[model samples]
Target: MVERATSLACDPSASETGRLLTQAFQTIRDDLEVRQAFPEAALAEIEQAVADPELPERDETDVEFVTIDPPGSMDLDQAMHISRDGAGFRVRYAIADVPAFLHEGGALDAETRLRGQTIYCPDTRVPLHPPALSEEAASLLPDAVRPAYVWDIRLTADGERETAELYRAMVRSRRRYTYTEAQELIDGGDAEEALLLLKEVGELRIAREIDRGGASLPMPEQEVGVGTEEDGCDYTLSLRPLLPAEDWNAQISLLTGMVAARIMLDGGVGILRTMPEPTEGAVARFRREVEALGAQWPEGMPYGEFLRTLDRTDTRHLAIVNAATFLFRGAGYTAFDGELPPEDEQVQSAIAAPYAHVTAPLRRLVDRFGLAVCEALSAGREVPDWARAALPDLPDVMEETGRRAKAVDRACVTAVEAAVLRDRVGEDFEAVVVDGVDGDRVQVQLMDPPVSDVATGSARLGSAITVRVERADILAGEVDLRIVGRDEQ
Candidate 1:
């Protein structure tokens, strides 16, 4: 670690900060050997696959389905429509039919398996499949009439599952609504029937989730991006607001995933995305932390329900959210051939259900295999040989890519933090102690710059404190802070 600033002048401007962060990002890319280009043979195969005819004997194209995603996303994996069916609701979710274009052991398949999933960086995206297919041909783009594996999921008025079925079909998206646009439409009362049903169903499903004791850390996401002003380029770090429509949209995916898990389990073979329930000790520790923060965790209230009461912008709540990370440990994929994994290992504790990742095949490699397995079982057919053979190996590949992706994300955030605070050494900033309450060093989140990094100190969990920057190492992506005093909350 570079202890003192020697290479750059004092009080580095935003341009200098941006340059340093960019350099650090590039170094991480090189160290990870992140693949950016597809092989010529893979590209050739993708071109041919893209030009191939769409699936025949398919229906559901006139269902007026629509897609909701982040702005500028091209690899649209899902499009959906919701409607009231008598006393129940019908959700038609169409996921991109990745296996339709993927041949077993082919070049495209080989490339996707190697990538495992889309590895996103601040500056670039390493997609699992070539853009020709993931973004254009096989993507669930609006009015494109793409082939898909459609889920007809029926739920009662209380959001209890009635029946779920999956079938191959061709579908057309009526429009692509970004999260903001969709939320605005819903809020303005101009939302169509489907959007209205989404809200109703989403709330109902959330109630069901709470009943199941599912816990989710709904922390607001912090993002760093490059911006240019008249003076020079600057790095802007901001938290993206979580919208209601985003949550509603995600519920639809979860519904589909849970349905897939049930089918696979019944059929006696499939891959499941699993997480062990948080242990009693971990939950108790979190409860103690919450109590120390002067927050109430109602007796007998589920942990997940209590977390939902937190406001992300509040420092104390932020600390609680940070502490909640312990409960989310041990997430992994389980591929079973003849028997389900142990019951304790089958449920994703967060969702409080057996769940599979069958929704986002375009960006994730495991989803392809899971989708294949679910489709076969849904059709009362045997799981394909290739799919079954790849099941046991998918967990390791997914874990590797998952860790790599997490490292890249963390590195980018750390780089931006170091850059933003590079010239602020010895300056006091308000922060909340999120971790290391009893340890020698604590982790803190700066209130002004909105950065989370390590600080050396002993502080109460969730207590607001003041810290002085000790060092900011841009190359190493570190911002070391020294606790100076407690900021009265």
Candidate 2:
């Protein structure tokens, strides 16, 4: 239930809590053996590759393209140019051409395969590619012409996708607007045609997503902060509300991925990002939990639509979002060479469509190969033998890397959670038991501070109660609480 955003701030020198968190994060990295730096061979290869990249013959730099991303992000992966195309729209989406710079099976390729994707930890970020490439050279930085996998998609007046094609090209981004900046422009009516069309197309795609039974988790993001006061240090986890521009931008990526999957399937080879639907039992449990959280789950409402109703600003609703993570189970990569996956297994149930990871090649290894495969297929050329051969092993590589990343995330968040609550040892909090009520231990969520953890006490699940904090260990990332009494009022 952890959603890590770009850190709001960090000050290890100012406070003990900050120092403890830094030490804990480093310990996890050391314990897990996560690569802190690229190997010399990989770095050397990246340097040589940057010096002489194989740029595309096609030039799309004349079309003014802009990127919308998180503030301070440098490893930009995508750029877009939207324009009117006869009663509908023309969307030109450009993805970073990692394949242009990377040699198959080289040292850099080996390094990125192991890292899998960039891990965004609070203390530090573990990048998939070296900063020289991911941040400076190969990144889709504004005003810098670079090779990219460009998707030219045509949409109907109803905002439905009509036709899509991909090709390699030399492109340049004119400006980079953060999500907030993009949203401000749209709201203030000062945005260009591309930015305005984004919102229009995004809402239509979202509607289509719901109509198609797509369920996406709107994970609440939190920013960790450490501040120095006159008396002591204060540590807090604050919710960072997501802007509408983020969702609009994501729709563009999703649209391209769906189109890429179609191409891969049509071409008779490639991999897919896949997931299975939640079981009936899981849905039932979620319904009961939603009711327990003081919300109504109207009968027959799809969980995805119900999720869209959640208010991210409300702490109670945020807990509902946290609890909904259970439905995001069984997500993984499925690779195929000749025969397509059985009709039933082909769909990514979460998106209610056939989807491929064709975006974000800068940060994800699979996307690099995916883009290469799609580009070759779109060009009516033979699929690269290296990419075809590597399909079988991709699923396993991604799973291993994803598992390790999740473990690191849980540890870091647990330590931060404990550290935040350590100061109030004897305080009583109004809490609701969310799980484990039948046993000696139960998981409780505080109403005020929005912390949830296992407490050694007996209570009915979902019942409001008063709890006293007994112990919290920052280094161990552990907390102890005992329920004193039930809250009747």
Candidate 3:
């Protein structure tokens, strides 16, 4: 974990940051043995695939699907378009079909299995597949004919999915749009006709999902800015907003996931992604805590439903929602060979029953496996032996990979935030109490600047207070604050 810092010199060229990032990559390389046998062969095969010019082509200029991604992301996976269909919605999700080019037991597939997913550091990226495949031949680039797995989904007026069909086809992305640009089109009073139609569909989908039991949280995120020095990376804490289009796009994925789950469940011989209902004990404890804080929890409601209500009634319940996420237990890959795992007792009891991962095949190997299963089942063929064998170990592998990705992401963000705040040591700021402790340390939230920190006893969760930044270390990634006084209101 990195600590917050108070002050640091800035480097315009990001040279210093690049070096540190290189070291981080080196550490990952050694840890995963990425430089040795795994990635080398994979890279060669990928380069060959990219250079090959003989491939099928399809006309995609009419649909005009555009990509939404982070700036400078070349390994684009998804492009989408939404249209209205008689008071309903039509969503076309086109994903880069990497599997189409990479052989089943080829170098790229083997390497991807080992790496699990792409790793993003402050200054560099460790892609799961080699760049030639992930970024060039397989990437859904604009104006270039490429292979794709298209999910054409239709939804009812109320957002219930009516039908979905998947097919391997050719696509040409019309444009590459960033989240910022898509958001502007959504927020600006005048949006393109197609974008406006997309917004309407997206809003309907989000509204319907929220009405069901989906949980939405506004978690703060940090972005990295490259600079000139050896360790010169400017870390900025930036809030990534969930635009209507984003939500709408997500709904398409979610709908597909649910459909896949249902398909596997019906077949009774495939892995599914499952999340269990919240435990009675955990819910009870949370209820007591909320009531203790003079908050209300409607009785006999499911946890997801309860969370939606809390979102409306208590603003501070956001943290509680985060905490409750842990109680829901981890969802994982579960394989079945005609015999279902016991309904009452399973190995990973935390997850809801019958789990599968069918989204983001480009980003997750497990999803690729799941997609293969769906394809086989859809074709009425026997389940592939290799996929079934891999299923048993996928839960642990995915879990470990997910944990590592989260840790690295958090470390990078904390390092950047520390760098950003290091210069403000000793400056007084108004903060809200996010977590209150009595003996030695308490946590406070700076409302205007919107940062959270641990301070002395004068601050408690939900209490407003004043605090002064005492210390920040960019190298150590540490941020420390001292209690100035409690806010009088």
Candidate 3 on 1-489: residue-level lDDT in tens?
Answer: 222222336532255533444455445445544433345777677667667633445545478787877667788788777778888878877877766667667777767766777777664566777666777888888887787767678889877788776656678888887767877877885656556766667676656555655554433343455433354444445433345556555655666666676667666766766555557687787676556555566786555555545532333553454445555565555667677766643322322223356766666778777776766676577767767677777767777776777666665655555555666877888765655456778756565455555776564445566888788665555678777788444
lDDT per residue for candidate 1 within 83-115, as digits (tens), equals 999999999999999877777798878777778
List the global CA lDDT of all models.
Answer: 0.84, 0.83, 0.63
Q: Which stretches of candidate 2 lie over 4 Å from their true place?
A: 1-10, 225-236, 291-294, 432-438, 447-450, 458-465
Q: Indicate whether candidate 1 or candidate 3 has the larger lDDT.
A: 1
- Tell me the lDDT of candidate 3: 0.63
Show pairs that collide, candidate 2: none
What TM-score fits each model? 0.94, 0.92, 0.81
TM-score of 2: 0.92
lDDT of 1: 0.84
Winner of 1 and 2 under TM-score: 1
Worst 10 residues of 2 by lDDT: 1-10
